[model samples]
Target: MTKQDALFQYCLRLGDDALILGHRLAELCSRGPFLEEDLAQTNIALDLTGRAQLYFQYAADLEGRGQTADGLVYRRPERQIYNHLLCEQPNTDFAYVIARQLLFSAFDRFLLEDLCTSKDERLVEIAAKALKETRYHLAHASDWVYRLGLGTGESHRRMQQALNDLWPYTGELFEIDDVGLHLLEAGIAADLHTIRALWTPEIRQMLQKAGFEQPADDYMHTGGLKGIHSEHLGHMLSEMQYLVRAYPEATW
Candidate 1:
């Protein structure tokens, strides 16, 4: 693929990740464990959704196909999306939510930092803005990891279970494919391998502080980058696209 194609796909993947995770977080709008946290979570969801729009607008511009951000988001098939698998995982519980956020935000924090130095000016700007939000997201998740992991016997157990269940999905975040390789060669993409190095130690440190063991990274799930996703994404799309699908020609 040409550099433009690779960049387009890259933006789409980033946008997809934000959109799905934002939606997942939105599901917790009024269901947070407490009032302050409920508002915090909703704000984070908005941050992610707004980020998705930026990335999608860039992608649409790159594609030059007259597609709007809303069209790309609401009209695409599930298999056409390129979000990471971890973002699509369900919020089974509060512990599960924190664990998932911990994994994703930790990596995203470093990834966006790396992106801030990318050769592409647009990517650099997007990354710079996103890194600020991701820093807060990482802080929030890391705090919860400690709170839930060290809270009580049941909370600790649930936190550990969530970590174990989600660990397998983490590998895909660092898996570089052809598009990524091309972008890397052009200096337009962040080096995930380098980000992985930074991500591991911080995650380990947080887990250590929480009196929790790190899950083994032996066999990880994959395929999200290639538009392959878990069953949850389709169901999410069904709900997320309901209005758009029902009124394709309606303008508001």
Candidate 2:
């Protein structure tokens, strides 16, 4: 693929990850375990959705397509999406949600930091803006990881299980595809392998402080980057695309 194609595809993946995860987190808006947490989740959800909007805008410009951000987000097929498997996984419980956020935000924080220096001016600007938001997200997730992990016996057990259950999907976050390779070679993207090094240590330290043990790295699940997602994504798409599907040309 050409450099522009590769960069555009990579941006779409970033956008899809933020969009899908934001939708999942939005489901918890008024349903958080506590009032304060409900507000916190909603705030994060807004941030993710806002980030996704920015990504889709850039993706549209890069693709040179007439598609608007809303169209790209709400009208795309499953295979066209490039989110990591971890982001699309089911939000089982509070602890599970926090685990997902902890892992994703930590990875994103480093990714954005590196992207802020990209040779591509637009990407560098987007990354610089996103870096500020991601920093807070990482802090929020880290705080929750500690609170749930070091809380009461039940809370600790649940958080630990959440970590173990979600561990397999974590591998996909660092799985670079063909597009990523092109971007990396062009100096428009960060090396996922290098980011992984930083991500692992930060995650490990957070888990340790939370009184949680790392899960055995037995099998690593992959394929989401290639559009092969878990069953959960279909349901998420159904709900997210409901209005768009129902009224193809309807506008607010």
lDDT per residue for candidate 2 within 18-99, as digits (tens), equals 9989999999978998899899998888988898999889888887858788888888998888899999888799988988
Best by TM-score: 1
Q: Report the Cα lDDT for residue 35, model 2.
A: 99
True lDDT of residue 53, candidate 1: 97
Error of model 1, residue 126, in angstroms: 1.0
Give candidate 1's whole-model lDDT.
0.93
**Model 1 ranges off by over 4 Å:** none
TM-scores of all models?
0.98, 0.97
Candidate 1 residue-wise lDDT, 1-252, digit = tens = 889999999999999999999999999988999999999999889999999999999999999879889889999998899999999999999999999999999999988988998999999998899999999998998888888888999999999999999999999999999999999999989899999899889888989899998899799899998899999999999999998899989865
Which residue runs does candidate 2 get wrong by more than 4 Å? none
Scored by CA lDDT, what does every candidate get?
Answer: 0.93, 0.88
Superposition TM-score, candidate 1 onto the true structure: 0.98
